[model samples]
Each structure stands twice: as C-alpha cells, then as structure tokens.
Target: MIHDQTLDQATESSKAKKAVLYRMVMDKHTCPWGLKSKYLLERLGYEVEDHWLTTREQVDAFKARHGVTTTPQTFIGGKRIGGHSDLRTHFGLRLQDPKATSYRPVLAVFATGAGLALAASWAAFDTPFTLRAAEWFVSMTMMLLAMLKLQDVEQFSTMFLGYDLLAKRFVPYAYAYPVLEWTAGALMTAHALPWLSIPIGLAIGGIGGLSVFYAVYIQKRELKCACVGGSGAVPLGFVSLTENLFMVAMALWMLARMI
Candidate 1:
C-alpha cells in the first residue's frame, strides 16, 4: 500500500511539471521578453505548451480573453505564473526589491568611462599604463556624469537639493553645478588650464564630500543620490561618497603634480 501511494505522488509531481505559455510572435517583430520567458520555463524542467499569436489581432484577442495587459503569460498546474520576472520570483530566483534604489546607472557610467580612458591610454602611451591613465579615467568619468546631469538640468537640480548643502542654500548653484563639473572635467582631460580645473574640482569635491557625509552618515537619511542624473533611484551611500572622494583625490593629485 505504501509503495503504491509513493508511486501515485511521483506521478502527480511529474504531471505538475507541465506548463503553458501564451506569447506574441508576429512577422514584423517577435517579443524578445516572450522568448526569454519560454527559455526560462524550459530551463526549469517544465514541459511547455507554447501558444504563439502570429498576428496583432490574434495577440489582442488573446490578451482580452485572458484579461491581461501583457504577454508571455505562463500557467503551471492551471495556475497563472505571470511574466518572465514574475516567473523568476516564483522560482525564488529574483530577490530584488522593485522599489529599492540602485547604483547601477552610476556604476555603468564609471565602468564605461574607465574602459574608454584605458583604451585612450593604451593608444597614446602603449603598455604598462601609468598614473596619468588613472587621472584620465577619473576626468572622463566626471565628464560623463556631468553629461547625464545636463540631460535634464532642472530635474537634476531638484534632486541635487535633497542633499547638496550649497544647492539647498543657493538654488543657482544647483543649476550651475553641471556646467562647472563639465568644464573641470574637459580641462583636466585636455591637461589645459590647471588653475581653473584644479580649483573647481577641489571646491566642488570638498563641499560635496562634506554634504554627502552629513546627509548619509550623520543624519542617516535614506535618500536617492543624484550622481548619475535626476531619476533619484540611485541610493545615497558609498558609491555617491566615493565619486566625491575620487574628485577630491584627483584634484589633490593634479595640484601636487603642478606644484
């Protein structure tokens, strides 16, 4: 009797591995996310029943019938498992908080800028790199960050006021901050006008470091960092502080070399 019961339970478990995925795959454009969902399901050992909607009308009809706004909808044991991200959550794979702030945008900008600097260094000076390469990397990163802020200066300024002591006191400083950073970065990269670039870097970096420390550590405020842009999803923490410290270090280094 016990052996028969175990066999029945195993059979039920095997049956539960069956899944259905309804997705859009039209001629003009097949949904990339839909393909991702199908791949995820198959990789997880599910026997997927793939239903492809080949026309826009068919896609619309399917969505309407299912009362869902988006496709690649999944069903497991006759239960809706939602989209790709949702499916990952169901499998305990995705642990990200949807509302939590991230430093990805800033990190990406720094990474790409650093790569560009290294490439420039290799092309100009050849092998073994140098301290100058590090300087170039920092300068280029600053320029990129400034450009991101310049995309929507008004929005950036609004977010900037949250933690920047100068911005909070003098609204115009917030508006002018991106331009100052850009000018400093451009001059530093070109190794031109050290007088202007060094001062700007030191002033901004010093003020920024102090403000970030006070807001993030002293006050312990959980606010968004405006480092990358005005989106305000980047958390105010180590990454933000590090950017300022890098600026300060670079400025000091340049000053010492000049002296």
Candidate 2:
C-alpha cells in the first residue's frame, strides 16, 4: 500500500513539470540553441510541448506574438522561461560570469601537467614511482609555464614587473625570464650539467619566492600572477608562491645530490 502511494505521488509530481517550448526549425537552418534549450528542458523532467516554427513567416509571427527577438523560448505554466541560459537560471544552475576572472585555466594546466608527469614516471619506471619522478614533474611544470609566457613575452614581462622585484629593477630580466625558465627546466628534465641548471633554478626561484611573498603578504597587494601567462586570470597568492617554492626545493635537492 505504501509503495503504491509513493508511485502515485511521483507520477503527479512529474505531471506538474509541464512546459511549452517554441523554437525555430526552418528548411535552410535548424536553430542550434533551440535544440539545446529543448534538451535542457527535457533533462530537467519537463514535459515539453515542442512547437516548431518550420517557416520563416511562422517564425517571425511567433517572435512578434511573444515580443522576443530570439527563438527557443520556453513557457512553464503560462510564464516565459526565455532561452538556454535563462532555463539554466530557472533550474538554479550556476553560469560562468564573463566579467569575472577565473583560475580554471591554470588549474587545468596543473592537472594535465601532473597527469603527464605520472604517466611518464609509470612508463619509465614500473610501479611505485621514485622521488626522481617528482623532480621531473616540477621541471615539466616550469617548462609548460615558460611556454605560456613565451606566447606573448611582452605581455608576460609587463605583468611580471608588477610583482617581480628583479623584473621591476631590471626590465631586461622580464624579457629573459621565460628563456631562463625554459632552459633550466629542459636541462633538469634531460639530466644535463648540474653546474648550470642548479644555479639558474636557485637564483630565479629564490627571487620569485621573495617577490611573491613581498607582493602578497608584506605589501598586501591584490594582483594577478604571471606564472601561467600574462593573459591568465590566476590570482596572486598561495598557488603562485607554491610554484616558486617547488622550483627552489627542486634546485636545492639537485645541488645537494650532486655534492
């Protein structure tokens, strides 16, 4: 008896989610956003009345009647639900704000870089990867970051000068920074001459650490980090500092191992 009652209640709940979706479906072109809206409505458990305006005249009439310039308009219980984005809001889904800065790009880079490192380690040395793999990961991350900077070196240098003490004093350092990072990372990854790689890594990483510390902590300046690229929106804080610290630690470890 209880099971039957629950089934009936769920059926009634689903019945209440009725919606009307009016979208363009012409001979020359079927609206892409219209399909998206229909998919979203159906996914949200909406029993949609799919009204297709197959002709241009029909589409214009529909738009004029609804006082809307766009197709793929939805209506629930006689209330207009607008387009794909509007339906998303109606269902309480979070949308990306174009005006806002996000760290997703940088985070994606780190995640991909880590996966590459782990894969490389597994391929080179079977199960239970060693500390050398971690070193490779750090070196690879630096190389990836350098590549991003090299995409627009001038822009990167400008952003770097904002928080980098060395760059601010010697503008030429900003231009040379990416090249130095690339060289150091490549040399470290290849297990090349420690005499060159270790000192370059130590100097750059140590300076970067101090610069990040002073900019974020001491001076308390709110700024974007140039670590991932000048065009990126990655915030200047813990993550940026961690990148510098990783370089410093790797360089020191390599130096000690050599000694």
TM-score of each: 0.83, 0.77
Task: For residues 50-81, write the lDDT of model 1, one tens digit per residue.
Answer: 99989989988988988999988999889998
Local distance difference test, per candidate? 0.85, 0.85
**In model 1, how large is the Cα lDDT of residue 5?**
51
Question: Which sections of candidate 1 miss by over 4 Å?
Answer: 1-17
Name the regions of candidate 2 deviating beyond 4 angstroms. 1-16, 20-36, 49-72, 99-103
Candidate 2: deviation at residue 184, Å? Answer: 1.8
Per-residue lDDT, model 1, residue 148, is 93
Using alpha carbons, what is the TM-score of model 1? 0.83
Residue range 32-138, candidate 2, lDDT tens digits: 98898788666556788999999989988988998999888999889998987887676655566764667887788787777777888888888427776787888
Clashes of each: 0, 0
RMSD of each: 6.3, 5.8
Single out the weakest 10-residue window by summed lDDT for candidate 1.
Answer: 1-10
Which candidate comes out best when scored by TM-score? 1
